[model samples]
Target: MSNNTNKILTALAAGIAIGGILGILFAPDKGENTRKKIADNSKKLSDSILDTVKEGKNKISGLKHNLRDRAESLKESVEEFAS
Candidate 1:
Protein backbone atom coordinates (compact mmCIF):
# COMPACT_ATOMS: atom_id res chain seq x y z
CA MET A 1 0.00 0.00 0.00
CA SER A 2 2.83 2.37 0.89
CA ASN A 3 4.56 1.57 -2.37
CA ASN A 4 1.37 2.21 -4.30
CA THR A 5 0.87 5.50 -2.53
CA ASN A 6 4.43 6.53 -3.27
CA LYS A 7 3.98 5.71 -6.94
CA ILE A 8 0.83 7.78 -7.12
CA LEU A 9 2.44 10.74 -5.38
CA THR A 10 5.45 10.52 -7.66
CA ALA A 11 3.26 10.50 -10.75
CA LEU A 12 1.26 13.45 -9.48
CA ALA A 13 4.40 15.48 -8.78
CA ALA A 14 5.79 14.67 -12.22
CA GLY A 15 2.59 15.76 -13.89
CA ILE A 16 2.50 19.04 -11.97
CA ALA A 17 6.13 19.81 -12.75
CA ILE A 18 5.67 19.05 -16.42
CA GLY A 19 2.52 21.17 -16.67
CA GLY A 20 4.16 24.08 -14.86
CA ILE A 21 7.19 23.98 -17.14
CA LEU A 22 4.99 23.92 -20.21
CA GLY A 23 2.95 26.85 -18.97
CA ILE A 24 6.05 28.87 -18.21
CA LEU A 25 7.51 28.16 -21.62
CA PHE A 26 4.37 29.24 -23.43
CA ALA A 27 3.86 32.46 -21.45
CA PRO A 28 4.75 35.77 -23.15
CA ASP A 29 6.07 37.43 -20.02
CA LYS A 30 9.47 39.13 -19.77
CA GLY A 31 12.50 37.17 -18.56
CA GLU A 32 12.46 38.49 -14.99
CA ASN A 33 8.73 37.98 -14.62
CA THR A 34 8.96 34.52 -16.09
CA ARG A 35 11.68 33.56 -13.66
CA LYS A 36 9.66 34.83 -10.75
CA LYS A 37 6.63 32.96 -11.87
CA ILE A 38 8.61 29.79 -12.23
CA ALA A 39 10.04 30.23 -8.77
CA ASP A 40 6.63 30.80 -7.26
CA ASN A 41 5.19 27.83 -9.02
CA SER A 42 8.06 25.65 -7.91
CA LYS A 43 7.59 26.73 -4.31
CA LYS A 44 3.91 25.93 -4.46
CA LEU A 45 4.61 22.54 -5.97
CA SER A 46 7.17 21.78 -3.26
CA ASP A 47 4.69 22.68 -0.57
CA SER A 48 2.07 20.42 -2.11
CA ILE A 49 4.50 17.54 -2.33
CA LEU A 50 5.49 18.02 1.29
CA ASP A 51 1.89 17.95 2.38
CA THR A 52 1.27 14.75 0.42
CA VAL A 53 4.27 13.07 2.03
CA LYS A 54 3.10 14.05 5.49
CA GLU A 55 -0.35 12.70 4.81
CA GLY A 56 1.08 9.47 3.47
CA LYS A 57 3.19 9.11 6.60
CA ASN A 58 0.14 9.51 8.79
CA LYS A 59 -1.78 6.90 6.81
CA ILE A 60 1.10 4.45 6.94
CA SER A 61 1.38 4.92 10.68
CA GLY A 62 -2.29 4.20 11.14
CA LEU A 63 -2.04 1.08 8.97
CA LYS A 64 0.92 -0.10 11.02
CA HIS A 65 -0.99 0.30 14.26
CA ASN A 66 -4.01 -1.50 12.87
CA LEU A 67 -1.90 -4.37 11.59
CA ARG A 68 -0.16 -4.69 14.94
CA ASP A 69 -3.44 -4.86 16.74
CA ARG A 70 -4.75 -7.50 14.33
CA ALA A 71 -1.62 -9.58 14.75
CA GLU A 72 -1.95 -9.44 18.50
CA SER A 73 -5.54 -10.53 18.29
CA LEU A 74 -4.65 -13.44 16.02
CA LYS A 75 -1.87 -14.53 18.35
CA GLU A 76 -4.22 -14.55 21.30
CA SER A 77 -6.77 -16.57 19.39
CA VAL A 78 -4.16 -19.16 18.39
CA GLU A 79 -2.93 -19.51 21.98
CA GLU A 80 -6.46 -20.05 23.27
CA PHE A 81 -7.17 -22.65 20.60
CA ALA A 82 -4.00 -24.56 21.42
CA SER A 83 -4.67 -24.64 25.17
Candidate 2:
Protein backbone atom coordinates (compact mmCIF):
# COMPACT_ATOMS: atom_id res chain seq x y z
CA MET A 1 0.00 0.00 0.00
CA SER A 2 1.37 3.37 -0.98
CA ASN A 3 0.81 6.67 0.82
CA ASN A 4 -1.78 7.81 -1.69
CA THR A 5 -3.71 4.55 -1.43
CA ASN A 6 -3.73 4.82 2.35
CA LYS A 7 -4.95 8.41 2.22
CA ILE A 8 -7.70 7.56 -0.23
CA LEU A 9 -8.93 4.64 1.87
CA THR A 10 -8.90 6.76 5.01
CA ALA A 11 -10.85 9.51 3.29
CA LEU A 12 -13.38 7.01 1.96
CA ALA A 13 -13.89 5.46 5.39
CA ALA A 14 -14.31 8.85 7.00
CA GLY A 15 -16.85 9.96 4.39
CA ILE A 16 -18.90 6.80 4.88
CA ALA A 17 -18.87 7.13 8.68
CA ILE A 18 -19.87 10.82 8.65
CA GLY A 19 -22.63 10.21 6.15
CA GLY A 20 -24.02 7.29 8.11
CA ILE A 21 -23.95 9.28 11.35
CA LEU A 22 -25.71 12.32 9.89
CA GLY A 23 -28.34 10.18 8.19
CA ILE A 24 -29.15 8.32 11.36
CA LEU A 25 -29.18 11.46 13.50
CA PHE A 26 -31.80 13.20 11.39
CA ALA A 27 -34.11 10.21 10.93
CA PRO A 28 -37.50 10.35 12.72
CA ASP A 29 -37.20 7.14 14.62
CA LYS A 30 -37.41 5.93 18.19
CA GLY A 31 -34.21 5.38 20.18
CA GLU A 32 -34.48 1.62 19.95
CA ASN A 33 -34.98 1.71 16.21
CA THR A 34 -32.13 4.18 15.73
CA ARG A 35 -29.79 2.00 17.73
CA LYS A 36 -30.69 -1.05 15.70
CA LYS A 37 -30.10 0.85 12.48
CA ILE A 38 -26.78 2.04 13.76
CA ALA A 39 -25.75 -1.47 14.61
CA ASP A 40 -26.73 -2.76 11.19
CA ASN A 41 -25.00 0.11 9.38
CA SER A 42 -21.84 -0.34 11.39
CA LYS A 43 -21.78 -4.03 10.58
CA LYS A 44 -22.18 -3.26 6.90
CA LEU A 45 -19.52 -0.56 7.01
CA SER A 46 -17.05 -2.92 8.65
CA ASP A 47 -17.68 -5.65 6.12
CA SER A 48 -17.28 -3.19 3.28
CA ILE A 49 -13.99 -1.94 4.63
CA LEU A 50 -12.72 -5.45 5.18
CA ASP A 51 -13.57 -6.37 1.61
CA THR A 52 -11.81 -3.31 0.24
CA VAL A 53 -8.68 -4.02 2.24
CA LYS A 54 -8.64 -7.63 1.16
CA GLU A 55 -8.95 -6.62 -2.46
CA GLY A 56 -6.10 -4.21 -2.15
CA LYS A 57 -3.96 -6.84 -0.47
CA ASN A 58 -4.61 -9.32 -3.27
CA LYS A 59 -3.76 -6.75 -5.91
CA ILE A 60 -0.54 -5.82 -4.20
CA SER A 61 0.44 -9.45 -3.79
CA GLY A 62 -0.15 -10.11 -7.48
CA LEU A 63 1.90 -7.09 -8.47
CA LYS A 64 4.75 -8.22 -6.25
CA HIS A 65 4.84 -11.64 -7.88
CA ASN A 66 4.73 -10.17 -11.36
CA LEU A 67 7.58 -7.81 -10.61
CA ARG A 68 9.64 -10.61 -9.13
CA ASP A 69 9.12 -12.77 -12.19
CA ARG A 70 10.04 -9.95 -14.54
CA ALA A 71 13.17 -9.21 -12.58
CA GLU A 72 14.25 -12.83 -12.78
CA SER A 73 13.64 -12.94 -16.50
CA LEU A 74 15.68 -9.81 -17.03
CA LYS A 75 18.47 -11.20 -14.89
CA GLU A 76 18.60 -14.42 -16.94
CA SER A 77 18.68 -12.47 -20.20
CA VAL A 78 21.52 -10.31 -18.97
CA GLU A 79 23.49 -13.35 -17.77
CA GLU A 80 23.05 -15.11 -21.10
CA PHE A 81 24.18 -11.99 -22.97
CA ALA A 82 27.27 -11.64 -20.79
CA SER A 83 28.25 -15.29 -21.14
Candidate 3:
Protein backbone atom coordinates (compact mmCIF):
# COMPACT_ATOMS: atom_id res chain seq x y z
CA MET A 1 0.00 0.00 0.00
CA SER A 2 2.74 2.45 0.95
CA ASN A 3 4.71 1.52 -2.16
CA ASN A 4 1.72 2.20 -4.34
CA THR A 5 1.22 5.56 -2.69
CA ASN A 6 4.88 6.44 -3.19
CA LYS A 7 4.64 5.48 -6.84
CA ILE A 8 1.64 7.70 -7.32
CA LEU A 9 3.35 10.62 -5.64
CA THR A 10 6.47 10.14 -7.75
CA ALA A 11 4.43 10.02 -10.93
CA LEU A 12 2.58 13.16 -10.00
CA ALA A 13 5.81 15.00 -9.26
CA ALA A 14 7.33 13.87 -12.56
CA GLY A 15 4.25 14.99 -14.45
CA ILE A 16 4.38 18.42 -12.86
CA ALA A 17 8.10 18.75 -13.59
CA ILE A 18 7.59 17.78 -17.21
CA GLY A 19 4.69 20.17 -17.61
CA GLY A 20 6.72 23.01 -16.15
CA ILE A 21 9.65 22.26 -18.42
CA LEU A 22 7.42 22.22 -21.49
CA GLY A 23 5.73 25.45 -20.49
CA ILE A 24 9.05 27.21 -20.02
CA LEU A 25 10.37 25.84 -23.30
CA PHE A 26 7.37 27.13 -25.25
CA ALA A 27 7.15 30.52 -23.52
CA PRO A 28 7.47 33.50 -25.89
CA ASP A 29 10.32 35.40 -24.32
CA LYS A 30 14.03 35.14 -25.06
CA GLY A 31 15.97 32.86 -22.73
CA GLU A 32 17.59 35.61 -20.71
CA ASN A 33 14.35 37.56 -20.38
CA THR A 34 12.42 34.43 -19.60
CA ARG A 35 14.81 33.60 -16.80
CA LYS A 36 14.47 37.10 -15.43
CA LYS A 37 10.68 36.99 -15.63
CA ILE A 38 10.62 33.64 -13.85
CA ALA A 39 12.89 35.01 -11.15
CA ASP A 40 10.78 38.12 -10.72
CA ASN A 41 7.57 36.12 -10.60
CA SER A 42 9.03 33.74 -8.03
CA LYS A 43 10.19 36.67 -5.87
CA LYS A 44 6.81 38.33 -6.07
CA LEU A 45 5.01 35.12 -5.13
CA SER A 46 7.34 34.56 -2.21
CA ASP A 47 6.92 38.11 -0.98
CA SER A 48 3.14 37.93 -1.28
CA ILE A 49 3.02 34.68 0.66
CA LEU A 50 5.27 36.12 3.36
CA ASP A 51 3.20 39.26 3.62
CA THR A 52 -0.01 37.26 3.90
CA VAL A 53 1.44 35.11 6.64
CA LYS A 54 2.62 38.16 8.54
CA GLU A 55 -0.80 39.77 8.24
CA GLY A 56 -2.47 36.62 9.50
CA LYS A 57 -0.09 36.46 12.43
CA ASN A 58 -0.80 40.06 13.31
CA LYS A 59 -4.54 39.43 13.20
CA ILE A 60 -4.22 36.41 15.43
CA SER A 61 -2.06 38.32 17.88
CA GLY A 62 -4.55 41.15 18.02
CA LEU A 63 -7.36 38.73 18.71
CA LYS A 64 -5.35 37.11 21.47
CA HIS A 65 -4.62 40.45 23.09
CA ASN A 66 -8.26 41.49 22.84
CA LEU A 67 -9.42 38.25 24.39
CA ARG A 68 -6.94 38.60 27.22
CA ASP A 69 -8.14 42.10 27.96
CA ARG A 70 -11.76 40.98 28.01
CA ALA A 71 -10.93 38.12 30.30
CA GLU A 72 -9.13 40.42 32.71
CA SER A 73 -12.04 42.83 32.72
CA LEU A 74 -14.44 39.99 33.48
CA LYS A 75 -12.26 38.80 36.33
CA GLU A 76 -12.15 42.29 37.81
CA SER A 77 -15.92 42.66 37.54
CA VAL A 78 -16.49 39.37 39.30
CA GLU A 79 -14.05 40.33 42.06
CA GLU A 80 -15.81 43.63 42.65
CA PHE A 81 -19.19 41.94 42.78
CA ALA A 82 -17.94 39.52 45.46
CA SER A 83 -16.46 42.31 47.59
Candidate 4:
Protein backbone atom coordinates (compact mmCIF):
# COMPACT_ATOMS: atom_id res chain seq x y z
CA MET A 1 0.00 0.00 0.00
CA SER A 2 1.06 3.59 -0.55
CA ASN A 3 2.35 5.65 2.37
CA ASN A 4 -0.73 7.82 2.36
CA THR A 5 -3.04 4.83 2.43
CA ASN A 6 -1.00 3.29 5.23
CA LYS A 7 -1.20 6.48 7.27
CA ILE A 8 -4.96 6.71 6.77
CA LEU A 9 -5.51 3.09 7.72
CA THR A 10 -3.28 3.48 10.75
CA ALA A 11 -5.18 6.51 11.92
CA LEU A 12 -8.47 4.71 11.47
CA ALA A 13 -7.27 1.67 13.37
CA ALA A 14 -5.96 3.79 16.27
CA GLY A 15 -9.25 5.64 16.42
CA ILE A 16 -11.25 2.44 16.47
CA ALA A 17 -9.05 0.74 19.06
CA ILE A 18 -9.08 3.75 21.34
CA GLY A 19 -12.83 4.12 21.03
CA GLY A 20 -13.36 0.48 21.83
CA ILE A 21 -11.09 0.69 24.84
CA LEU A 22 -12.92 3.74 26.13
CA GLY A 23 -16.23 1.98 25.75
CA ILE A 24 -14.95 -1.04 27.61
CA LEU A 25 -13.51 1.08 30.43
CA PHE A 26 -16.83 2.88 30.93
CA ALA A 27 -18.82 -0.33 30.86
CA PRO A 28 -19.78 -2.36 33.98
CA ASP A 29 -16.63 -4.46 33.78
CA LYS A 30 -13.83 -4.18 36.35
CA GLY A 31 -11.16 -1.59 35.55
CA GLU A 32 -8.29 -4.05 35.94
CA ASN A 33 -9.84 -6.53 33.58
CA THR A 34 -10.55 -3.87 31.01
CA ARG A 35 -6.97 -2.62 31.13
CA LYS A 36 -5.60 -6.14 30.80
CA LYS A 37 -7.76 -6.84 27.78
CA ILE A 38 -6.66 -3.63 26.12
CA ALA A 39 -3.00 -4.37 26.79
CA ASP A 40 -3.22 -7.90 25.42
CA ASN A 41 -5.08 -6.82 22.29
CA SER A 42 -2.63 -3.98 21.65
CA LYS A 43 0.36 -6.29 22.05
CA LYS A 44 -1.09 -8.84 19.66
CA LEU A 45 -1.92 -6.19 17.08
CA SER A 46 1.58 -4.71 17.23
CA ASP A 47 3.22 -8.12 16.87
CA SER A 48 1.07 -9.05 13.89
CA ILE A 49 1.72 -5.73 12.18
CA LEU A 50 5.46 -6.00 12.76
CA ASP A 51 5.51 -9.50 11.34
CA THR A 52 3.64 -8.38 8.23
CA VAL A 53 6.06 -5.50 7.62
CA LYS A 54 9.04 -7.81 8.05
CA GLU A 55 7.59 -10.24 5.55
CA GLY A 56 7.02 -7.49 3.03
CA LYS A 57 10.58 -6.23 3.44
CA ASN A 58 11.94 -9.73 2.91
CA LYS A 59 9.88 -10.18 -0.24
CA ILE A 60 11.07 -6.85 -1.63
CA SER A 61 14.68 -7.74 -0.88
CA GLY A 62 14.33 -11.08 -2.66
CA LEU A 63 12.80 -9.40 -5.71
CA LYS A 64 15.65 -6.89 -5.84
CA HIS A 65 18.23 -9.66 -5.75
CA ASN A 66 16.46 -11.61 -8.48
CA LEU A 67 16.17 -8.56 -10.69
CA ARG A 68 19.84 -7.73 -10.22
CA ASP A 69 20.85 -11.24 -11.18
CA ARG A 70 18.67 -11.15 -14.28
CA ALA A 71 20.13 -7.80 -15.31
CA GLU A 72 23.67 -9.06 -14.88
CA SER A 73 22.92 -12.16 -16.95
CA LEU A 74 21.39 -10.01 -19.67
CA LYS A 75 24.45 -7.78 -19.67
CA GLU A 76 26.76 -10.78 -20.06
CA SER A 77 24.69 -12.14 -22.98
CA VAL A 78 24.79 -8.75 -24.72
CA GLU A 79 28.56 -8.51 -24.23
CA GLU A 80 29.03 -12.05 -25.63
CA PHE A 81 26.92 -11.19 -28.70
CA ALA A 82 28.94 -8.01 -29.29
CA SER A 83 32.30 -9.88 -29.28
In terms of TM-score, which candidate is strongest? 2
Tens digit of per-residue lDDT, candidate 3, span 1-83 = 24775577557655655665567768887999878766766566556655765776688799999999999999999999999
Residue-wise C-alpha lDDT for candidate 2, range 1-83, written one tens digit per residue: 98999999989998998899789979999999999998999899989999999999999999999999999999999999999
lDDT (0-100) at residue 11 of candidate 3? 72
User: Model 2 — which ten-residue stretch has the worst lDDT?
Assistant: 16-25
Cα deviation of 40, candidate 3, in Å: 0.4
Prediction 2 global C-alpha lDDT: 0.94
Ranking by TM-score: 2, 1, 4, 3
Give the per-residue Cα lDDT of candidate 3 at 56. 60
TM-score of each: 0.82, 0.92, 0.64, 0.72
Candidate 4: the clashing residue pairs are: none
How far off is residue 56 in model 4, in Å?
0.7
Candidate 2 segments exceeding 4 Å error: none
Every candidate's lDDT: 0.90, 0.94, 0.71, 0.81
lDDT rank order: 2, 1, 4, 3
Model 2 steric clash pairs? none
Rate residue 55 of model 2 by lDDT: 97
- TM-score (C-alpha, index-matched) for candidate 1: 0.82
Query: Which candidate do you rate higher for TM-score, 2 or 3?
Result: 2
Clashing pairs in model 1? none
Worst 10 residues of 1 by lDDT: 1-10
